[model samples]
Target: MTGTSPKHDVFHAIADPTRRRLLHLLVDREMPVTVISSHFPMSRTAVSKHLRILSDAGLVKERKVGRETRYRLEPEPLLELKRWLAFYDRFWDNRLSVLKHLVEADDANEPETAVKPIKPQAMDPLSLD
Candidate 1:
């Protein structure tokens, strides 16, 4: 009910590929629904629905220019997504570092040996013996 919070979060809004593509399209510039729909294979109503979801998530802003409505990327909500991903990035980095250390330690403890290749015995293609 409060205007401070969005009806949908950034994650839910971007879950659909169509909505994600809409964000990419609106990133550089604002475009009306008709112009935006032209880039997609669906009807204008479908694009409008995606835009509505993005608007509810605060990922895009809509402006009224004369008779047409234009949409553009807001970008601020994406900071939450970036922060969430960053935590996982650091987590994986630490895990990889530990794994690397373990592998190197194991390698250092192994005895070095010359590897010899085994040769196959000659056999006829039709022989079952």
Candidate 2:
């Protein structure tokens, strides 16, 4: 696929814990499937399947090194995920600001001694009186 979009979206590919771990493993350097598979408890085939999904999402790139294929992380696709999460950050910030304003307004109307402290009472468990 020269200029076509990826078959899998970054969110879908990263939704699985296994796939996320695969991305982390390939982040620093490229390694053959054998080396990558050794890091996980699953079979080499299983690890290959996870790698395939990541590749489809454009999160990782594979290269032919002699007779073996090596994979490395391509982090450009993760920008989409980061952008999506940033929107929620701004949303929560605005919501928290409104909540803080409402709480301060209510506190200002209350008297300083409005809150009364409760005294602890000791009781005897076996007392009949």
Candidate 3:
């Protein structure tokens, strides 16, 4: 079977710091390009390019409002990412649980070491220089 489209994968879109910031900006509410660009240090055109990548990835949706285009987060694509991470999380959890049990069992089987008393050594008698 063929693999999924590169553009639709959430990982590729979120790899860039700028794109991740853009997604965070859109989280609370939808915003126009001008408003979103204001939050970033880059040019408005650069912001638009990032937004276009987000749109292609299915992570954001765009709506034309008269002469301007507004963008909002489209979270459905992120569900796949969540599921992928959750699978690994469970895998690591199980491995860690097994490791903990092994350590506890080893501790139970080992004999405890008794604390030894420190004996002060007597000073050696020697001729004074």
Query: Which candidate gets the maximum lDDT versus the true structure?
Result: 1
Name model 1 segments beyond 4 Å from true: 102-129
Instruction: Specify the poorest-scoring 10-residue window by lDDT in model 2.
Output: 120-129
> Model 2, stretches more than 4 Å misplaced?
1-3, 98-129
TM-score of each: 0.76, 0.74, 0.71
Instruction: Quote the positional error of residue 118 for candidate 2 in Å.
Output: 8.0
Rank candidates by lDDT, best first.
1, 2, 3
lDDT of 1 by residue, 1-129 (tens): 787999999999999999999999998999999999999999999999999999999999999999999999999999999999998998899999999999999999888987679999999989996
Cα miss at 21, model 2 (Å)? 0.6
The digit string of per-residue lDDT tens for model 2 on 31-128 reads: 99999999999999999999999999999999998999999999999999999999899889999999999999999998888678999878788986
Candidate 2: pairs in clash: none
* lDDT, candidate 1, at 83: 95
Kindly indicate the candidate among 2 and 3 with the higher lDDT.
2
TM-score of 1: 0.76
What is candidate 2's CA lDDT for residue 114?
61
Identify the leading candidate in terms of TM-score.
1
Q: Cα lDDT of all candidates, in order? A: 0.95, 0.94, 0.90
Residue-level error in angstroms, candidate 3, position 37: 0.5
